[model samples]
Target: MAGPMISHSPAAPPRPGPGRRVVLGRRVVLGAALGWGAAGLAGCGAGREPVQRLRLATGPEGGPYNAFGRALAAATQGHAPAVVPLATAASVDNLHRLDDGSVELALAMADTAEDAVRGRNSFGRPLPVAALARIYVNYTHLLAPADGPVRTVADLAGRRVAVGADGSGVQVVARRLLETASLTGGAGRVAEVPLALGESVAALCAGRVDALFWSGGVPTPAVAELARELPLRVLALDGPAGVLRARYGPVYTAAEFPAGVYGLREPVGTVGVGNYLLARTDVPADAVCAVLRTVFDAWRDLLREVTAGARLEPRFAVSTGAVPLHPGATAYYRSVYG
Candidate 1:
């Protein structure tokens, strides 16, 4: 009478064997797969939209533009969308990509971007694009060895100089500056050797070349390393200061590299242009907003990551001459400041 009514029949079919347990596990796995498939279909129809992918074209490896591109990729990884960075030839090439729909984003020198959008200077046709931000300034430095006699731009006459590789922004500006200084004549020669930055430094140190022109961000690693090991002098281009400013529309500014800033004995005054991020006009507004948000939000983190990042600021983003702001980026700027 005690447990007659509560007795389980035959111990409820005996606990399942290992084989039965295996079957049960298989059923669970199958059921989970089906449920996930259904949820995914539902998500496609009514849930969050799929993440968008963007391709950012940057400069040559080991350059400021490339470094910034990498930082941008890291910053936007966990964001709503995904961004991909493509290492390419510097500013001019990047502009071409933006125009042809080859890339959604690009890192370009402000001067180059200006030229592209207005069909002036390097760009032969008007390119439809907009600026996302001004990330840094590319200071044009004239690198000469300590014992070399090329003290100033004037002294470069009758001397060999490496004006960077062909199609490089360095070469374009170097030629312009040389022309302005009257340094390009039968007596003076420019060797168009397409060498990497490291190789150019070595060539200069070895006396194979008298001078090299480099347009890049402050604290450039190649220049810094060369300055440390060898006695180097960055010639102050003072002869055509007024001419460059007048011709280039004031986007060109006279900036000083203070003594010890790059192991220099005295401050060196040089001309420079700001660097900015460019995007094709066709990029979605939402994507542009996401990119701008990521960049400005992680500005501090980026500064710590790259030397050039320290110059990226909201105010600088709007300080451009020819490059117009993208509507999305302008919206973000107004939201943050106003």
Candidate 2:
């Protein structure tokens, strides 16, 4: 799928599509929209019984995860365990909170989830996490100074580069990109600086670093501000994108950054990584089922807030590589697809 570009002219969100009830062979039991059947089944599981509560870990304020999490929380208000969006440091932090039992649900980048499952990268040990659904795509941004000497990701060798801060998912993706670009752990490695999005922008504009790697939705406020202050150059990420997808999962894809977000006249070739809704494995299947039901049944409401949320494809839900589907989510899918 092409990386979604935010459209200035918003279209009315589409109504929730038909729902599936029972799977008899390959024929799907499409019936009365999403809620009719899902609503009935909501109380069938262990998720939202009476006053059961849940916390949804979202990205920092104003980020995509926060916005979508808020929409999701609102939709599930009377459905299952109460879901409250918890503003956090984003992907890596979300996963950490999920493992520590501080939160029951979270939003995380696919690569971050992959690393967590394998006990590599930022994660110290294997975490029992599973996919609730494959959500939206996060574009990988390789930004450099407009007139800087660096022209490509590989050229940053010996130059200063800002990955994200400690315990941030941006850092995980940044490190992976650099390793693939051959800019780390070698004779000509670049100088690494870790900072948050806003800080990275300031550092880049102030000449603190020659390049910065930011992975996020388009039109990130900080990047937009940086673009307005000085002409910026976006390095092409298509080169290493394929390798990343193969090493990771189909969650990573070759796509172009949307044009006009930063006053660009054309799209820039970049890589896109998906974000997922994850839950701890021990969550009741019925609860997972109820939440998934509410999520899709209220899908259109979410689209109104995050246009890219229209990409919540069902076929991709069960295939979130490296992580198993939560039993509740699996049950939901089987009932519909069986």
Candidate 3:
């Protein structure tokens, strides 16, 4: 049974432009001397302050957050503090871990981070966490088979859908999108299954699920792999994107999956959210400064490993919206701009 053709809005917000290329050149030298250089960061080096082992909460095994986190951990070895990446549900889980003192650093979507700091949605009260940087943009991917009956958001009614794991950012966006489309809760509820990215991909391929919601970078490895095995379509989501923005502030933006992504013949409009690197408010300023310096210094290396065209520019990193910058991060940025 072929699904109805999915058509995207012509006015879909233009795909987010590429990361502005900044020529590091001499700045790299100055930055290293004052910020992340081996000699400059003596506090993190041997024979100075004992190297602090900071637990960084990353996403599930096959996700971008996990990949980026691990790469960062590797980049900081023998230089900055020993960063240890812990695999967990992405975004929401990472923030919760940061709040509970289980993690010193976390990566989270801007929406979930805002909820935590504002005491809305999943969080009971304002959490004491701060942003280290806004690392990249995440595109909300609502995927279904090209041959399946599910075509539009409205078609998800009564369908078995993988809405991400219990403590993940994907679930947060999935529920809201379903509700806005009137396909969730009440009598028309979707059969929501909480599965991690890998499990969700397996479920969809095996016919255990009609569709799945994933919020990550363009060309998510799992989604691309699924496309090769079975024909698929990323549903157009311009309508839901508007509704979400009207309800929330500037957190949600209309974005599109470019043609050739996941084998799509055309672009698909969806939602976009910023991915932020966060830290527990209590983490030492010098430690956070060192980590930020290391990230900025080693960004190109990190970019090569991370997918979805992730960027790590200082200007982009500083645009964390409502999330307050950690004091250490603040110092690092000051050094960069000065």
**Candidate 2 colliding pairs:** 23-338, 45-286, 47-287, 48-81
Q: How would you encode candidate 3's per-residue C-alpha lDDT over 1-338 as one tens digit per residue?
A: 00101111112222233653333223433443465444333333234463477899998886888888888999889865779999998888898899999989999998999999998899999999998887777788888989989899888898899999998989998988988888877888999999988898899999999999998877787788889998997899878888998988777877878888889888788888778899998887678878987888877676564554555666567666678777667656545554
Candidate 2 lDDT at 29 equals 19
Off by over 4 Å in 3: 1-51
Best by TM-score: 3
- What are the runs in model 2 whose C-alpha is more than 4 Å off? 1-48, 300-310, 336-338
How do the residues 1-338 of candidate 1 rate in per-residue lDDT, one tens digit apiece? 01111110112223445444212112322333345454322321324454478888877777666777788788888765577889887778888888888888988776677778889877788999988777666678888987878778878887778887655677667878988976766656444455556678888888888888888866788789888888888888644555777887765666666677667777777776677788887665556777877887877665553453244555455555567666556545544443
- Model 1's alpha-carbon lDDT is 0.68
Q: State each model's CA lDDT, in order.
A: 0.68, 0.74, 0.78
After superposition, the stretches of candidate 1 with alpha carbons farther than 4 Å from their true spots are 1-51, 305-309
TM-score of each: 0.80, 0.80, 0.84
**Clashes in model 1: which pairs?**
none
